[model samples]
Target: MSDQPVHIIANFTVQDAAKYREYEKGFFPILKKHGGEFITFDDSSVTFEGTAPPQGRVVIFKFPTEDAATSWYNDPDYQSLSEHRRAGTTLNFLTMVHSLPPRN
Candidate 1:
């Protein structure tokens, strides 16, 4: 966290609605195991905007340290579930960003 925050942006392909929901069941638990938090989700309906549906799913989680982020990404449980996510959808781009430290 570095007294700031780590930001992540992941855009993905979700063709089946039911499968996506099922993936969540596996995902949310793994994330919680790694101390992850659910900040914002696409509300299961991306059509809220003209952007379109199945634009992909987005998630936001915070960690107190970069290592925690690394751990979460590399955890075995997540690794197993990640295979499902990868098989089910296409992840266009996933990024990790850390905010600039605040001025004293």
Candidate 2:
């Protein structure tokens, strides 16, 4: 795996609480399986610069490398679990950001 770290930033609006909870319950194990870590999530975030803050929640998670993040996203088990999320929420964005190179 590459040394570079990657982060997934998911912004979504929950439409069905029960189904979203089911997706949340199943997320961690799949994340761990692919060497990913849950960073944080914000439901009440403010946007200082943007015209409007995100509609709902913003979730952040990290992986040791980009490949690991992609693997987790593409995993069949995770995909199955993601169906719950899809059914329960409207995702505005699920972006992957690469960490900057370490300072020399």
Candidate 3:
């Protein structure tokens, strides 16, 4: 797999705070396990020029590599934890963006 860093952007509206909190409690551990870093999140995101701006909370996180990000998402524990998120929130998208390759 390529060593390029990968960023994940997620948009979702929390419908059940308790359930979402349950997912959050286990998120960092799983993320750290796969070398992922939480960047930032915005509850009130503004749209400048985009036609389809995210409707709810916007979160951004990064991983050292695409493989790491993929592994994090595919991990059994993470998948199990995500059930809470799926039940508690309306997910818009969980997109993966690849960083530019090294300028050799």
TM-score of each: 0.73, 0.94, 0.95
Put the candidates in lDDT order, highest first: 3, 2, 1
The lDDT of each candidate is: 0.69, 0.94, 0.95
Clashes in model 2: which pairs? none
Model 1: per-residue Cα lDDT at residue 49: 48
- Using lDDT as the yardstick, the better of models 2 and 3 is 3
Query: Per-residue alpha-carbon lDDT of model 2 for 29-71, expressed as tens digits?
Result: 9999999999999998788886864579999999999999999
> TM-score: which candidate is best?
3
What lDDT, from 0 to 1, does candidate 3 have? 0.95
TM-score of 2: 0.94
Q: Which model scores highest in lDDT? A: 3
- Number of colliding residue pairs in each model: 1, 0, 0
Error in Å for residue 90 of model 1 = 1.0
* lDDT by residue for model 3 (28-103), tens: 9999999999999999988877576657899999999999999999999999999999999999999999999989
